[model samples]
Target chain A: MKDNVKLMKGNEAIAMAAIRYGCDGYFGYPITPQSEVLETLEAQMPWETTGMVVLQAESEVASINMVYGGAATGKAVMTSSSSPGVSLMQEGISYLAASELPALIVNVMRGGPGLGTIHPSQSDYFQATKGGGHGDYHLIVLAPSTVQEMADFVSLGFDLAFKYRTPSMILADGVVGQMMEKVVLPEQRPRRTEEEIRRQCPWAVTGKDHGRTKRNIVTSLELDSAVMEKNNERFQRTYREIEKNEVRYEARYTEDADYLVVAFGSIARICMKAIEDARKEGVKVGLIRPITLWPFPYDAIREAAKNVKGILCVEINAGQMIEDVRLAVSDSVPVRHFGRMGGIVPNPNEILDALRRDFIDKPANAKED
Target chain B: MTREEIIRPENKVYSRPRLIDDNYMHYCPGCSHGVVHKLVAEVIEEMGLEEKAIGIAPVGCSVFAYNYIDCDWIEAAHGRAPALATAASRLNPDKVVFTYQGDGDLAAIGSAETIHACTRGENIVIIMINNGIYGMTGGQMSPCTILGAKTATSPYGRRSDLNGFPLKVSNVVALLDGTCYVTRQAVHTVQAVRKAKNALKKAFKNAIEKKGTSFVEVVGTCSSGWKLTPEKSNKWMEENMFVNYPLGDIKDTAAGLEEKTVEVKKS
Candidate 1:
């Protein structure tokens, strides 16, 4: 583990993890902050050394489609972009989700109503956690606060995607994408054999075999409402099963802490720092970092409610993940939100102040568990 | 029990290929889609790519092209076949991939995808049929329609000032460095049909060989859109449309190879 440790940015860590984990192709367009991802891979992809293919596409739309195409061949392929670019890819993403193609998509979100700014923002929480595209489907949205989690989550994302035959996303913000941190890489796993992939994704378009008894077709179009309803039900059932098997969360100091901070992605990183600061001042504050935003750590929050008096939901957006936090806590305890929108990242000092003002100062309002 | 005595069904003699199903086409009488379909099927058969090929069918007149083409077909959003084809080809590089598009589908709304696919040199074939009118939408003015050619939108002949000049898709695609073979052919007569077939075969071959992007624009006739009888529409194409949209190879890699070698030598 020590040997695998290195200082790397979030973007580089993602690219390296994808390559080491046998991701055979990457298709992407150049976007700020995330452009380093393409640049790093472009410089290193000496076709001889790595048998993978890297293509700089003309646009985000084309890039995502390319990933769609490569994934159809039962190969692990991925693409990355910022918020506006990710919006362009929604059409393809919806198609991928509908077709049940296993692929990875990373969105280093910046502020956006339409290209609002280039800085960090968690405004895309609604888009990522709920369905971004126009369809009745969901992407397994993973949010990583640390560079190490960014790398580790990608490998896990690919695993879950292939396991369920669905598209998965690593929903990070610009701050997490651009910030540099120390990380310990994991041992490279053996590439899944083609037979294994074929066995898993039996519906993949590997060309027709004359000897096969029946042809396999992959499509999202179901003209019959009843049939489409049944398909949606099946998808929902799978999502429920995923919710059961894949909810991940981390709690720090929640055992005795009076206030709990509910956060994710880059904002969660800042909350950890705030938690540390508040603890030094004798303010009993803890942090709850959500790793999987879709299969949200509801149960974890419910359990924390047993001891924690109040929860402060912090995010880069004005309020998106706060809604989820509120839903999870469900009036069992007082829940408050602190956030900054339009690319403004909340400062650690500001969060510490919010903790002092809302929970520490107002001890009477802090409900006892 | 002799082998010679064993009898096989006569229906198996000329059995339909895997990609082509037994279904009647929805195209109008004397429309060039039948010829185009046969040419594509013939090429697919020749290259033995039927089992591996994936075809993206565009909206407009060719929306139901998937019904006739036997391969795995994906129906794309309006004018988005190129993007869909790009994904399909990139995903299945070993598989033969192509998009069957019409004038409106390729030249108008999908222009961005069409140009980008060629510019990126995506290893795919684009079969664009330019019939100078939108058949599915009841004779709307298409991007490939000639000057002074009146349709439902341009009832008093197309005005260059009011409406833009007709788009030359083959010429535009030829300008892209990624396109290895770009040609414009007509399917008016038997001789022209043979030439168009040859061009189609070359384009598919180029894609199969992984040479680069290949585009073959076929000038077809739409009698229903033209409001002319099938016989008269053939004459109209020969007399009017052919002169404006001439049939010839806009960019031929085989011919350019000599010039490229010379340039390389100089460099």
Candidate 2:
């Protein structure tokens, strides 16, 4: 990836990485912030050179279903959409989850209770980590803060998706999606052959042949309650395994910090700036950036809490992830939330101010003493 | 004559296609799904695409079409089969892909997918079973439900003002230039069954040949759903179904077979 360094928007990086990762199909409907992802793919014309199939679908529903079709054939397929579009794709996403097919989805989030704004906001953290669709299911959620991460996480997301046979999403926000930054784009990997696909994904609907008596049938509808319950249990076990194994996070200035800040996606980048600023002032404030939002780096945070006075959960929303942060710390240390909702990504100075007020300047309680 | 001589291999005219699995269809005894499934199997077996054919089954009466057809099957969510089939056909250009859907699956919730895939000229076959009612959900009215037709949802005989007019999806899609072939046939009668099978064959052949969308709407009878006997339903189809949905080739404008513009001289 370091060989071909290029400055591109986060959306463009995702598109380039998808092609470089040997994605066989890209299906998407244009929406703001992430529309550039589709535009860049079309402009690059991967179909002419790499034979990757790209289609501008009718709607997000159709787009996700298109992803289903490609994924069913054991191909590397993906789709990118913003908030409203991602909402429409929930049904298909749940189906893909139920079928246990590997596919990549990128949600460059915009503000929304309902079409709230086009500006960056991390309001969809809960939706992405917890099942975004009906039924008991979960997607492997990767939150990328930087444009470089946007590019790298594409491959990482796909790898995890295929490894677990579950859908994976890169949950960035409008800021990371719109901003331009240097990224080392990966070299183009060729799409897999039919033989390779069958070998890689034996459960795929890859048409029966080579003395394979059982034709693959992909469906989620099991009428029997007991069977469906067992399927749910299997998914729960997989989630537990993922939690135990795939927890990823990055800690900064936490070696001798008094208070810790928790954030992810674009807000994590902002929190990093605040951590740096507070460190310059001799304020013992650190940051924990959860790369994988679902398996919420709980053990790492618990370890961080062993020294910190408390934790401050920072976000661009009305504190959705604070609950998870509290769960991580087990309420032993004081936990508080600071956020600015409705497209307002608070400044790093404001986060430092909250850190100063919430933990730095707070009087020692009798219980703590 | 001995049993072997009486029923020679040459004299054996009827047999199940190899692709039709031993699992019997869950359709009603008199339902036309069994016949259509056989035709699809016959086409795939005849074309020798058993190794490459992928069928996307819809979410209606024929949702379990995968059980009967021994091919790679994708049970699509509701009416989203067209979108899925489009991706399948486009991504794996060498593979033959098709969608088997019912009237509700094609004309109602998934109308957008069906129309868009057609307009995009996706190289896929859409096998539509328009039985005029939702048989899977216990005979509710579908988008293709006829006027004055009494269904579970429309128990008082559907009125145009109360319920919308029936959707003639094949006829509407035929208007799209993207479609290479569009036909409406029935399977109630022997001759009609043969015609329907021919239509399916052409549709599958179009996908194999990389032609654009091929849509085949087979006006079928749902005797259990229609609250009639199998014979009565077939008879009713002849008298009423054909009146609105005439069984014939609505459009046949594939590129290479366009009326033989270069006439051959009779030598």
Judging by lDDT against the true structure, name the best candidate: 2
Candidate 1 TM-score, C-alpha based: 0.89
What docking tier does model 1 reach?
acceptable
User: Each prediction's TM-score against the native?
Assistant: 0.89, 0.96
Instruction: Provide DockQ values for all models, in the order shown.
Output: 0.38, 0.74
lDDT of 1 by residue, A148-231 (tens): 988998889999998888899999989889999998887765555556766766676556544442434455666679999998
Q: Report fnat, model 2.
A: 0.85
Pairs with backbone N, CA or C atoms under 3 Å apart (clashes), candidate 1? A69-B91, A70-B91, B19-B70, B20-B70
Interface RMSD of 2: 0.9
Quote model 1's iRMS: 2.7
Count residue pairs with overlapping backbones in model 2. 0
Native contacts kept, each candidate: 0.30, 0.85
